[model samples]
Target chain A: MWQLYQFPLCPFSRKVRLLLGEKGIGYEPVRESPWLRRDEFLDLNPTGQVPVMVDTDRGVALIDSTVICEFFEETVDKAAMLNGTAVDRAEIRRLVVWFDSNFFRDITAPLLEERMIKRLVHRTAPDARALRDAMKAAVGHLDYIDYLLDHRTWLAGPTMSLADLAAAAQISIADYLGGIDWKSHEQAKRWYVGMKSRPSFRPLLSERMDGIPPPSDYDKLDD
Target chain B: MWQLYQFPLCPFSRKVRLLLGEKGIGYEPVRESPWLRRDEFLDLNPTGQVPVMVDTDRGVALIDSTVICEFFEETVDKAAMLNGTAVDRAEIRRLVVWFDSNFFRDITAPLLEERMIKRLVHRTAPDARALRDAMKAAVGHLDYIDYLLDHRTWLAGPTMSLADLAAAAQISIADYLGGIDWKSHEQAKRWYVGMKSRPSFRPLLSERMDGIPPPSDYDKLDD
Candidate 1:
């Protein structure tokens, strides 16, 4: 059996979980708060990050969300998320990086730092300026998403791909933290609603981070 | 033909260049200073980052270093950088991320900020403490490299892979910025020297960023 080490709020971990769900891969979810930098977890992944996949019986451990995604995409033939030609795959991967790096860095990361990490680790109030900055960045990001949806059926191309999963994962976390303002972002909101209603994303929306409550419309499909 | 848009000191671009060199795929190097955030470049990539591969004739723009490397690996298949089974490839990619994200964050990014960008963009002096911290981090990173070399021929495994390219690219930039100290990292030094002697790496070592002189032994194979 496979073990997935992750916390409820990590976007990268969520990305892996969504991919696993799509691929019909089963694994035991191991709750791990990477901020604690647990020694055992650090041993599994020197980076001290979560969303680590380990199979103790096989003595196999996969670290990094992207690495894990690529591994299963290679090992399992079902639900090809990185689909299409080499050029198409390149475009898919490009957006994956865009969401993973740019979207995370600009929006999700800051919200986590302010809303989640500061409250949990430091036991302090989040900076008002920082939260505002993240939410503002989210507006711009949603604008970019709207721009993308204007052209392609999906984020990357005609078919669904890892890009959708990556974007949804980050957006989910941002929404959970109350960083996203969905007003005036009809296209992005509609796209996100489609993503939120996915079977793979349902479980993620239902889960809550301890001591932190999401906005009222977080899990509601009608919102 | 392809146009690779990157500045000389950009480690991600160097990684792509190494892979292209090994695969015998040709690309025209187009100078791009991402920090400047030029209008045309921003239109090409909203991320405002280097290592963007474009073919105007085909209207294809491959952004992100990993995306570019994977594209060529899939399309060309001659050099086969992402070799081995799924697990092995995962290990290789994990290390690639290690160098690209962690090493770049702890060492290269700070050093570039202190030594290069402060001088170029801000016209300010580098913080002594920041330089000290980056060099200190470089020691730990080089120790990790030594540990990896103790167990395997290459950083990832038996053969030269994109992992080596990623590590060497970051290290080369760090070395050029005078952030790396080679006093105790004998194993890593030897491995890096081997990487330096490769024909692909030779051009990178010889190229210098304007007004920033590298250390005297920066290009020497004897180091």
Candidate 2:
């Protein structure tokens, strides 16, 4: 049996969930609020972060979404989600880091801190300066995504891989916050539409929090 | 032949260099200042991040230090830097992410922004507030590392792995700025002394930047 601790809105958590679903793996999910630093959760993961997976069969707990996902790939050795040769896997990993680190820093993180975190923490209002900077950076990132889509069927190559999942996860969060101007980048929007239609992506598309609701078209498969 | 574009003080860049050195792989090193954002450099890596490696034999350019290091492990398959079983590899990767993402964000980054970046950009004095916050966070991080070192021969296991390289690279940067109080963490210091004595660590220890000189004890293997 496998179990995972996750927060509904964290892109890293969403990426792992999608990977498991795509591989047709079954696991129990436990929602975690890392900021609260719950004792039991901290016992499982000293990092106090989400997407920690407990693989009962292996009798080991895995921390870090990337580590957990890659562990599944190595041990299970099925589903070939990382797909292809050494160079192909390298390309996929590069794109994963690009979305997880680069995009999150310049766009998703600041926006989340202002919009979601402020609301959750009962802080007054979102910081205008942070919002402006993130939105400006988003334009460039969105354009880059569009450019990548123009050349390849997926972000890294022909087949959909972790790169696509990582990118879409962040974009999904941004879309829920009404931060993406999809109409401005048709290619990127089209690629996302394809991702939305995947059965593995279904649960994430319909996710909702207590005081937050996604946009009306948030779960739609097509424009 | 492999050629790596890197910056001397970048932790991500250093991580890759250490991995290559430990693997005993030969490569031409190109020093890059990512802040300058050179056109040719940006052409090779759209993100313009340092530590991009081009394998002319493979005819592919790899971006992201972690990705590059992992690629070498996959292709070279000689060095057992990530040696051990699947679960063991997972533990090492977890620690790598712990250092690269978590530690970088909370401590190394803010301190670099205040101390190193300020000097590089020819800006005014370091921000006292940012420096204080980073220092406070550094203590907690150092304690965690110390606790880990108390239990293990090396982080994640009995062997030196990418986890150690990733961590030592970050700490080396902090140590350069005189951020570490080695006296406070005896076990961590002892482990570091062993790492500093390794031949793989030699080049990094001797590195000197234009206006920045390491503290007197920075390069000393047996202090």
Candidate 3:
């Protein structure tokens, strides 16, 4: 079995977990707190980021969330997330980058820094300005998601893709940190509700980081 | 032909250019300064980033450098920068992400912000401390590259891959900004020299970003 080194609150790990769950790929979850920068974890992945998949018996360890997802997408044929032609796949990959890089940068990263990291690691009070900034960014992000959904059935296109999983992964973490406000984002909220109802997303929603409590409706399918 | 939207100093654009050049693909260069965030450019790519590949006839635009790279790798098979088995490809991708994200963040981005943007747009002098810090980080990055070169013929493995292109692209930009010091990193320097000498790298070295000049030895292959 592949040992997935991840923490519950890591958006990247959550993205990979969703992919693994959707593909029916079995892996034992090995909790990795990347912020702690464990030496052993550094040996496995020099970058020291999580969502690493290690098959110890086979001596193969895949690092990076996208790398792990692409590896499985190549090896397994079931429930293809990176579906369709070159052009279509480009669209899917583009959105994946958008969420992973832009959304995470604007919303999730700030929330994690203010609401989670500062609280957990530094034992400091969350910065109100930073939290407010993240929430404001969340509104813009959800607007973009609503814009995307206006045309396509799913996030990327007609079919559900890794793009959806990536977006939800970041959004879930941001929501957990109380950065997201569902008001006037009905379209994005509806799509997210559909994503939350997925079996892959259930386990992630149920798992909580110590000393960090999500909003009351974070795990709810109908909020 | 794909029209590549990019600016000379953008490392991401350089990475995609290297890939297209290696793959023997031709693209018309359309200069796009993403920092400008022009409305039309935003229409082409909502993120307002460069290294976007657009096929006007097909009405297809591949946004994000990695997305553009993957699309070309899928469409073109001549050079195969992402060559090798699934596991090997994972390694290649992980390294690509390393250079694209980490290296760029630590070295290239700061250098560009300080040396280029500060000079061009902000009309402010580069911070001596930030320049010192980026140059310092460049040394550590070069050390890591030296370590990688110790094990493999290329950054990823025995075969040259997109990982090499990614590294070279970022290093080239950093080198242009005079951030990199090739001292005590013989292995990395040797590898980088080889990359710089390539036909693909030739055009990039020749192309100048307005108002910001590279170091005297920037384009020298045998410096």
Candidate 4:
């Protein structure tokens, strides 16, 4: 049994969950608040970050969504999840880092920090400058995504790899926060619709925060 | 032939160069100024990021250092360079991400953004507040690195892996900027000295910036 230490809304955690679902791996999800780091969680990952996976069978713990996904692909013998040759794997990893770095800071951070964290903590209102910057940055990233999607069915290539799951995880959170204006990019919207319809994505759509309701079409698989 | 598009000081680019050297692969290094978005470069990577690898034999272009390293490891079948099993690979990848994210922002960013970039552009003096925040963040990450080094010979584990190169690349840049205090973390410094002495690290040590001299003992390897 694998014990996954995670937070409800963290995109990194969500990516791990989606990978597990896609691989059909059964695991117990233990919700952990990153701010209030537990000793056990800290032992697993000294960084005190969420989405740490404790593989009880192997007696090993893994942190970082990219690492976890790669581990799963390597350990599981039945199916090959990562696409392409060495070159293809490299491209997928690059896209994963792109999502983690550029997308997180540009799109997800702003949307979550403004539309979600502010509501949760009753802190100062979201900074308009930051929000605008995020929106502007997101436009460039979305355009890049549109270009990538145009080249292949998924982000990395024809097959659905961890790259797709990593992207969907971030986009799903943005969608939950009402950050995405889907109508603006028709191709991106279509790609997302296919992602949302995946069996691995069903659990993500039903995810709800304490006081936040997902967009009207969030639960619609084909939306 | 593998053509590497890189900047001299970019840590991400350094990682790929180090990996190539370690693997005994010959490649042409093309110096790219990130500021100048070359048309051919932009066509290769729409994102216009540096450290793009053009493998003429395979007829593939790969961007991002992490991706390039993984690709190199997979394609080159010699001594196992990545180190260990699937779990170990996961741990190594996690550490690489940590260096790229937390360490780069906390340690390298402060030194580069404040001290180095200022010299390059003659901008406003460094922001004391941001510098302080970066310093504080560095203390925690350095402590974590120290702890990791204390337990093992390298950042990831026993054998020198991509994780070590990833860390060395960032720390080397910070050291060049006179940002790192070698005396503070004895273990990390010791591990770094070994990394600095490797044959693959000679090119990095010989590198000279136009107006910047690294610390007095920068090339001493034994430091």
lDDT of 3 by residue, A153-192 (tens): 9999999999999999999999998888989988999999
> Quick one: ranking by DockQ, best first?
3, 1, 2, 4
DockQ comparison, 1 vs 4, better candidate = 1
| TM-score attained by model 1 | 0.99
Among all windows of 10 consecutive residues in model 3 chain A, the one with the lowest summed lDDT is A114-123
TM-score of 4: 0.92
Candidate 2: count the clashes.
0
What would the per-residue lDDT of candidate 2 be over residues A44-65, giving only the tens digit for each residue?
Answer: 8888988898977768898998
* Candidate No. with top TM-score: 1
What's chain A's TM-score in each predicted model? Answer: 0.98, 0.95, 0.98, 0.92
lDDT score, candidate 3:
0.92
Q: Is candidate 1 or candidate 2 better by DockQ?
A: 1
lDDT of 2: 0.86
What is candidate 1's lDDT per residue for B123-148, written digit by digit as tens?
99999999999999999999999999
- TM-score list, all predictions: 0.99, 0.95, 0.98, 0.92
Angstrom error at residue B201, model 3: 1.3
Regions of model 2 farther than 4 Å from truth:
A56-59, B56-58
Error of 2 at B111 (Å): 3.2
